[model samples]
Structures are given as C-alpha cells and as structure tokens.
Target: MKIRRLASQIVLPILMVASTPALLHAAPLEPTRGGEGGRIIRVTTLAKDGPGSLKAAVEAKGKRIIVFEVGGVIDLQRTILNIDEPFLTIAGQTAPSPGITIVRGGIDLKGHDVKISHIRVMTGVDGQAKLSGWEADAFSTVAAHNVIVEHCSFFWAIDENMSTSGPRFNGKTVKEWRAATSHDVLFRENLAAEGLADASHPKGEHSKGTLIHDNATGITLYRNVYAHNMERSPLVKGGAQVLMVNNMIFDPGHRAVHYNLMNLEWAGHDYVTGEITAVGNVMRAGNSTAPGLPFLTLGGDGDLAWYSKDNINVDRWGNPAPMFGRYGVTKAKLIEKDSPMASLGGLDVMPAKDLETSLLASVGARPWDRAPDDIRVLFFVAEGRGEIIDDEKVVGGYPHPSPTAAPFVDKDWNLKTMEPKSGVYPGQKGGAQEKLSARDEAMRENAK
Candidate 1:
C-alpha cells in the first residue's frame, strides 16, 4: 500500500523583531476596571524571580489580565507561583528564544477564564540520569475552569536505555500525575515534542477535560513517545476526558494509541463520560525494533473492553493494525485507501448533517478537518523522496541515524482513506461469503 508522508519542519523564524509596545498600543481587549474588569500586566524579565515579579504585578494591578511580556528567555525554575483568580490571560512575545520552561512548581489555577499563548514550556534536562530543574514540569494546573493553553509547546527529555528496558517499558513505572487539572481547557495550535533523550517519562498519565484541538500535539517523538503514558488510554486508569482531534501522534517506541483499563478508574471517579474520538489523526509507528502494532488496546480485556472505529483509521504497514484484548469497539469504523484498513469492513463517519451545518456556520473549516478525506494528503520523508515500503524495508533502507532512529520510519509509502465505509457498527461479525460479496461489489463499482 502507498503510505502518506508529511514533511515536518520548523516553519517559523526563530527570531523576530520585538513588537510589545506596538501590540500594547494597537488596541486593548476592552480593559475592565477593578475586580469586575480585567487589567493587562506584562512580564519582561529573565530573572529566576521573574515569576515572582509577574505575580506581584498581577496582584498589584488587582486585575486578571496578565501577559508575560518578556521577549527573551525566562528560566522558570518555579517561576509561576500561584493562579488564584479567574479571567487571566498570559501571552508571550512572538519571537522565540529559550522560551518559558517551568521546571518545578507550575502555576496553580483557581476560578476560570485563563488564557496562555505564544510560549514554550520545556523541561530542560542535562542527561537521562540528571534531569534539569525544569524537567520536573514547567507549568501545571489545578481545578482551573474554562482555561485556554494555546500556541505553546511542552517538551522534556528522557533516558534512552532506561525507557526501553526496566520497569518503564512494562508501563509500570510511569504513573498518572499532572501538575494541574483543568476543566473546559483548550490546548490548540501548540506543539508537544520530545527532547533529546526519551522524554517519555511521566507516562501513562492523563490530562482531564483537555481539548487538543488543531495542534501538533505530539511531534518529533524519537524514542519513548507514549511508551508508558498512562493518559494514552482514555478508558484506562489514568485516562481523562479529552477531545483529541486533528493531531499528529508519532511514536517510535510502542503503539501510538494505547487503551488500557488500568487508567479507566480515574475517568469513572472524575465523572468523565466522554468517549475518546481519535478522528482525523495521523499516527506513524516505529520501524524495525519497534513493534508492528502501532495501536494496542490493553486491559478492558474480554467482552467488556472498549474499541475505536468510525472516522477513526490507521495506516496498514507503518503501524500494526488495531489490536483488541478483551473489550470491543461500538459503532466504530476504520478506513484506509489502498490499505488493509480500507478492506476491513467499515464506513465513513464524516459529511454527516451535523458536520456540514457546523462547517457552513463557522469562519472556515475546522482545523481538524484541514486534511479531510476529500483533500489530497501528501507525505515527504527527510530524504526528500517518496516510495511505498513495509516497516522492515523502510527501516532497513535507512541507516539508523541515531540509536533513536531504531524506532522511527525513514522511508515509507503514503496512504489515504478513500471511499469510507458507510454505516457499520463495531462488535458485529460477518461471514467470509458476505465479506467476499461486498469486496466484489466494490471492485465492480471501481472498475466501472
């Protein structure tokens, strides 16, 4: 099958002219007065006490609007002190330096209406063993409602060997622990990439009530991408109620999308009743050393397990086909153009009445719908060449660039979901004759 390739590049310039004054002068967002109205505060320093200064300014202003105006690097070694009020807006400069990296003691939020934009919250680490003070986690939230975390990045590093071997690989060491718990949170147009080492620690964790809308959620993950992410499986113990759409999740280690029952308890306790909708996502699995199954469903074992389908699809070769342990999918369908998933009985879930109505009323197509099945999807490898190859072929063809390369696919084909199946529910079985009849009809139609 032909694989679809997309070239990943840093498009924005690293440096740009400072325009804080101009932005401030242009137009204010309807400034409010006193506690009832919101005020704007700018933080433009790179001191270890930068967060302290910012917090003081916010308190002094007595307004909720707080902007991180510092254009240069601000080392966040516990910079953000506390976030107690609502209607807070923290915006950074457009230019990029080291950006804002919070190590330990992230921002704790209370109330609602918090907005953060144009910043990179990275965890700086020295080596796999010696984590930088920032690797502890740059920013965290707690009981914050209607929060918006947009146009930002979250990164960390991990040990290469330790991630693959030891208890970490078995998904035991990585536990679910978020610095914060946000409701109605929006994480849009951001990038969550892996640092130098395996940065997949703190795995098997969940971020509740998060809307991962239109972002490069997981990009450039070399070694342990979601190896031990407890949050990976929404039905699992650490899993949370998350709306993940229009994102790219690439894992060179284990399955890119892992659903485990171990993390589902948290969902029940938190009263999170939303199902994980893996729609319009691009997931690329690891190469040689990497397991073929790019997606795995652990726990939820037997007949009571959960499954994914409907508008939810996967590439045939790059990742292993979806695996079901005990649970099964409900009203789910999988599709792939010229791939195995395509042949698997399923139907398209898009172009529904609701989707068309929403698209017509919106400003434009939803970010997640950019590469809709109707659009032409393209893939470009680092080598600047395009070809279809199996996992083994792709891995063998490209010399492992780094030990990390052991998990990423270098040369591979590109495939798209075409002619999505129509109206098929999960957990239903069909006889071989029925399957053959359907295939024959599709073939005849295509021939015509």
Candidate 2:
C-alpha cells in the first residue's frame, strides 16, 4: 500500500503531541503467522523480478517457500508484496552468492510466523537509479507477528560528495528516500551499504518490535561487525523498550544508539516507558572530515527527550582503546593481565576500568611515566602543589560535551579561558582557568 504523505506527516506528529492519550488508547498489535501452515515452493527458476515470483508462489499456495538455488538478481520496482497468509517460510538454501542481488520496492509480511533469510536487497537500479524510491525499503513487515529477516543485505547507493537543491538533497547535504515502515522484524547477519550519492534514506530502518541482533548494519562492515545503523530509531516516546545486546556496531552515521521519540507530536503514541538496553555492543562514529558533527547526539529539536536513566548500559566507545596512532593493537595486548574489562563484565560487557587502562596504555605512559628524573620529580611536586580537578564530575555535568576536558587545565589549576582550545594538544592548555570557565558556562546554560 502506498503511504499517504499527509498521513505520514500527521501520524508522526500526532504520535508526539498526544503521547499520553495515545498510550492510554493505543491497542497492541495482534499476533500473526505469515502462512506458517502452507506448502513450500523452491524458487529454482530465476526471475528478473523476485517479488513477482514470490507473488506467484503465494498465489499457488496460501503458504509456501521460495528458495534460491542459483543466486541471481530479483528486482521489484516499487511493488508491494502483501503476504497476508500465515505460516510461511521463505528460506534460502544458502546465503546469497557474492554476485546475486534481490531488489524490492518493499516486502510487507502482515501474517504470522514468517521467516526470510539468505537474501540481498539492492535498492538502486544500474542506470535508472533515482534520488527517491530507487529500491524504497527491502523488507517492511508491518503489524506482522513473529517475523524474521536473516542473512540478508539491504543496500542503497549514496554519493556523499554531491550537491543537489531540492526537498531531500540540498547541494552537499545528504538525504534518504521516504518509505513505509517495517515492524516486528528480526534482521540478523545482514550488510547494508549506501553507494549512491543521493539516495534519500538511511540504511537499516525498522519500526517497533524489531530486533537487530548480530548483524553488520553499515558500510565496509564485515560479517561479524555489527556496526551502528543510521536507519533504526525507537518508535516509542519518553524511552525505548528494545533489547540491543552483543552487537558489534561500528562507525554509525549518528550516535550508535538513538531513541526516536520526537514524532510524539503527531500520533501521540508512546510505547516506550523504560531504558533500552545496549549491553556489550561496539559503537563507533564515522570518520567524516566535513562540517557535520561526529559522535552520538541523544535528542534534539523534533526529537523526543528522554531521562538519562532511560539509556541502559550503553558503552559509547565500544573499544576502550580504538587503534592508537597509525598502527593498531590487538585487544589481547592492550588489556592488563587481569583487567576488570577483560573478564568481569562477561564476554559481552566491557567495563570502565578496562576502557581507561586500554586507552592510557595505547597513548603511552602517563606524563609521570614519560618524565625524566628531574621532570618526574618536578611532576610529582607539581601534582602535590596543584589541586586535583575532579574530571568525572565536570564531564558528567556536561555529558558528551564537545572540546572535551583536556584543554581546561593549567599548572596552577586555575580557571583561564572559555573559548574551545585548538592546536596539537587542543584542550590541554590553560588548565584550571579554561575548566572553570567552561564549568561556569555549562552551569549557567543548564540553569537557563
């Protein structure tokens, strides 16, 4: 079904504006099985358009299987596959071979108990790819009960160097195509890449009741790299109730984890009530040397504001010590023999102690360790004479603030400058003076 633009705009806003009322009145989605009780159809024959073949299979039997033996391209041009039946399994004999591409406008599974695996969805056409609706969305199982999308790669082409002036793209600014929502979905072992310069949508977008565990969700991501996805945002306002764990999220466009609660003004729907757990997940910010800001941003205008407690165990920097300098060190080397991050948090969790030690070691010994005998003695004396500034408290007050903390200190530990630092050791100069200024500014800003 084509989504009405007006409805789409109104729905998101209404969800934000009437959050309380909608939560009180919103009905839970009924559980369903997408043709779980039907016959199986092996898709041995390759079709230029896979969706048509899938539709044909569904027509033959209310429930069936579409298997791909010799992987080939299956294109779906803005067509919707509404598998309204129940108990269906579209299994692949094996993951799609390197050359195979399965393009779809979108796959909507409204039934119950459906499983689709071992497929690759490419949204861009070879020559006719457009800024909008190149592939649209590969899989969208709205209101479907128990849906699974595994071992699949959904890719779009994006060109970061282009400049277009229009709704979705304004010159150098990047944009994404608009599409329908996919709910109750499980995306595992998938790779999504944006190759085009003007593709209008982010890769890996999903709705409520979605689980993206153990998947590579970004560019240059390998099979085991579960990079942060720009597409996913929690539908519930106030907080996210999703469980995200043990995923290796690398170089996300935005913050590794985002709580999508801003649209509360539209539908007034608020399904989130508590913290969304991001345990044992590796998150990295993309390295883009552009005007855009890096690092994860929690909430902004048109976005829902959540209490700090609503975010559960999110290790902002997954790898305590990302590769230092030009060379990279193995995790085994940087961590101490019996570091807490190495074992205590289980194989999944990486603790703060481990994180700190790893980072310090990667950057070489502390100033004391590097100092000559005279300097070392002087350093100790300096430490004894200088006041110890509680960095944790200062940073905590302005969590994730730019310019960080290194620049605000001086030899005497007195407040100095307010302007952000620049140069080789940017935030390392003016010490106490800079820090106090920043602290006061932050406090005043908070008060305002």
Tens-digit lDDT track of model 2 for 151-261: 344443221100000121112311121011222344333433332332333332211112221110111111122222332321222222233333333333333344332
Off by over 4 Å in 1: 1-37, 50-52, 55-62, 78-81, 93-111, 127-135, 157-181, 195-239, 261-274, 287-289, 300-320, 323-448
Candidate 1 residues 1-448, lDDT tens each?
A: 2111111111211111111111111011111112223544545554546353455644443445444433333444433456666656664432122234333223444545666554444343422232222223333444444555544444432221001001111222222222233334444434443323323234421221111211111211110111112123112222333334344443323334443333333332332122243443444442311344444343332112222433222343443345432234433222222322112112112322122112111111111121110011111211112221211122121111111001111122010110013211111112211113578899978999
Task: Tell me model 2's lDDT, rounded to 2 decimals.
Answer: 0.31
**Cα RMSDs, all models:** 18.6, 25.3
All candidates' TM-scores? 0.47, 0.45
- lDDT per model vs. reference: 0.30, 0.31
